[model samples]
Target chain A: MKISNKKQTLAFLKKHFIMQLATSYKDKPAVAVMLYAVDNNFNIYFATHKDSQKSQNLLKNPNASLSIWEHHSALIQASGVVSVVKDAKEQSKIMDRLADAATEDESFWPPVFRIKGDEYIIFKISLSWARILDLEQDTIRQKDTPFTELNFK
Target chain B: MSETKKALIILNDSDPVLGRVCKNKFKKQAGWDTILSSTYDEAIKIIVQKKPGFLITDIILKNSVKDGLDLLKFIRESDDKDIAKMPVIVFTDLGQEPDKKRAFDLGANEYLVKTELRIADVIKRIEKFIS
Candidate 1:
């Protein structure tokens, strides 16, 4: 599965966590953080509180985006729309699978696990499109050959 | 980062265009070596075989019954303690607030947005972390 320029892309994916889930209400911005899981099909999955702000925002407007990035390892980032699942049966199936993959913390249940006896949320983010950026591997200018390429420093 | 570290990328989807972009950023801007991959099954194999200081992976991988996020969970929960604690970076297209929260809740060290993040910026940020 190695691709041509695999170095930077892999670096970007390596040591990062904490995705930014974005939702809006009447054009107002809302953001939240949650645990996420990725499937082999290239789908991003995550869970959250049914009564959370993001849930309310999604209820009003499901249109949203999620950002997963690294502070280090070059400039690798991904953003795209999220498809929210509200069906209890379907959500349960997805969450059950995710729970199996999750750690003890990831698999934990909150007191409000279900609201009105309905709990658990699952979201999938599809790539409207994707981009990869890594500015840390610049080597062309450092060929060690002396050609008067101007250096700012 | 003193421009002294190497970068390894492991992903499930075979996207050369995006891979090139990420390689250029770290190699040219931050001064590091970079490696990329297109699948989680293979990527995890690499991790198990070798110990890399850092990792960049796609949450949504290709050719797997599971995606990159699931890979992260496996690594964290696996019996191999060494890899379970390694720094993990997630490359995904999900930028929503809830999505971000869930990724972290699962155990990803950081998340990157594909579109908004640029090469130079990524390099700078990575440099800051490793440096």
Candidate 2:
């Protein structure tokens, strides 16, 4: 089915806390599974060590892609520009939200919060475009394309 | 007596017309009080003392020891949670994307180009948040 509004996309984002983040630099690409938090504006926030591959890649090139999916249920794919959230207060707030999101899975805690010695930084992904596939609805099964796209730019 | 909420405006230099316009419009239109400060130091002092409902500031402050971006950083980094979380609108003549991005990265709630919008439009934008 067509995702006619932002609320549908936002609801899917809020319902899921984990995403596969893809980043690239110098023609090399890397992907990591991260616990993330979403704001009302569709900005995705996650924390990582300053020296992590993703962080280093983002510092060199801010373009990134992310995907969230559930088994036989739904999927969301998005691309955005990433930027470091340098403000201490803002970082703390985002960390709190990330921690809250992590609570859904008792066995898992966001690694940035647990790691020691190295400084951790928060990054925000401001999504420019996104597409959602809702297998549960199955409204587009007969159509040539089975995705609903939302352009934020 | 009930106290009216206050809105603070920080500008590069003293502009009597802009100050008067904001004060009159905010007070008359929304029953909110408005305070204007032209320096970073003075703005910080007012923020701590008055605890305005929201803030509107320019990017450049000619007379202040620190510029408006510095002031924005200070607010976002304030130890006081209330002050740190206060809504801030960056109203500046700088219309560049980098400036806007910097303001947002610093936690500004809104960014308005001074040349592109009238004072009335700015006030309306502020009202959308405060109301």
Highest TM-score: give the candidate number: 2
If scored against the real structure, what TM-score would every candidate get? Answer: 0.43, 0.51
Worst 10 residues of 1 chain A by lDDT: A144-153
lDDT of 1 by residue, A1-153 (tens): 111243433333332334567788886888876555555444566666556777777777766666555432233334546678778676655654444333223223322222232233567765443444333344665444321111111
Q: Which residue ranges in model 1 land beyond 4 Å of their true spot?
A: A1-153, B1-3, B12-14
Off by over 4 Å in 2: A1-4, A112-117, A137-141, B1-131
Chain B TM-score (model 2 vs. true structure): 0.89
> What TM-score does the predicted chain A of each candidate obtain versus native chain A?
0.58, 0.89
What lDDT score is found at residue B93 in candidate 2? 78
lDDT of each: 0.58, 0.79
Pairs of colliding residues, candidate 2:
none
Docking model 1 quality class = incorrect
Q: Each model's DockQ?
A: 0.02, 0.01
- What are the per-residue Cα lDDT tens digits for candidate 2 across B1-131? 12467789886563322344455555655677778788989999999999888899988887777888888899899999989989999988799999999999999999999778754577667776774
